[model samples]
Target: MAPASPAGSAPASPRLPAPSRGRRPGMARLEVDRAFPRSPRGVLKIARTLVALAALICFLASDAHEAYTALAGMETVITGLFLLLYLLRLDARMRCLFWPLADIFNSVVAALFLLVVGLFAIIIKTNKGTLAGGVLGLILLVLCLVDVVLLCKKISLDKARGRSAPAK
Candidate 1:
């Protein structure tokens, strides 16, 4: 058996600290739910990714430039990862693997692309396919913005609580 700790000692785990005078006696610690980020942000990301994929499909083989191709591939991967994160419930566990800033960065980039590409496609040429894809991209932009806002809120709350965005 392990030896008993001294009368005054700290626990072994670094994730949490011993109760302090600042906290109420016998009160349970408040924690962010494991599924917190998965709810609105994950759901919105999935929807936006699907819209992006559909837009890409409509214009596939039409764009000879490599920029659109790279962007399409990125969108596909983003879609897959978003779905995976939701299904696996990895948001709370991802803090060790990556920083929350990555999430914010990705959302900002996706939103910018959706706005720019969508507007450019719509304005450059007036056609059924372009119009459809452009409108879808704009819809995706709105969703991405929503995700970004939610992520920022989560990040701020985590910081205020002295916890990582993915506390687990």
Candidate 2:
């Protein structure tokens, strides 16, 4: 017979409870939604993205070549930022990606860029194509303005709460 084991000893071949469903034993898993449907800023960011995308689509379908050219760069920047934020949101879990100051800065820049592009495109020309692009561009600019306002409010609230700004 084997020597008596110490009191309260576990089995010689210790076994872990069967891993849940598909995960391997000892793997750490963090639960996160496929998309950030719960975050307000995430929704707002997505709305801004849709507005920018609409402007781009209008430019493509419109006859206004000049307006499209002028607005292209600004739209690209907004779209890129949107994609980055959205991709990061997939893994955000419960962690706050809070960067009120940075968001404010981005919102301001996007608003200014959209405003300038919209005005420049309108002053330069107007056709059926330009009309479509211009109208969409205006909408995009409004969304940017909303983003700026929301971000500014968040920044002020954060400051009042004594939270330092995010690192550059």
Q: What is each predicted model's overall lDDT from 0 to 1?
A: 0.69, 0.64
Expressed as tens digits, the lDDT of each residue in 44-95 for candidate 1 is 7667778778777655645523454456568768866766665665655565
How do all models score by TM-score?
A: 0.64, 0.60
For model 2, state the Cα shift of residue 17 in Å: 9.9
How do the residues 32-114 of candidate 2 rate in per-residue lDDT, one tens digit apiece? 44565456666777776676766676677665565465465456565566546555543234236554555667777767766
For candidate 1, list the clashing residue pairs, or say none: none
Deviation from native of the Cα of residue 50 in model 1, angstroms: 1.4
List ranges where model 1 is wrong by over 4 Å. Answer: 1-38, 61-66, 91-99, 165-168
The per-prediction CA RMSD against the true structure, in angstroms, equals 12.9, 6.8
Clashes of 2: 1
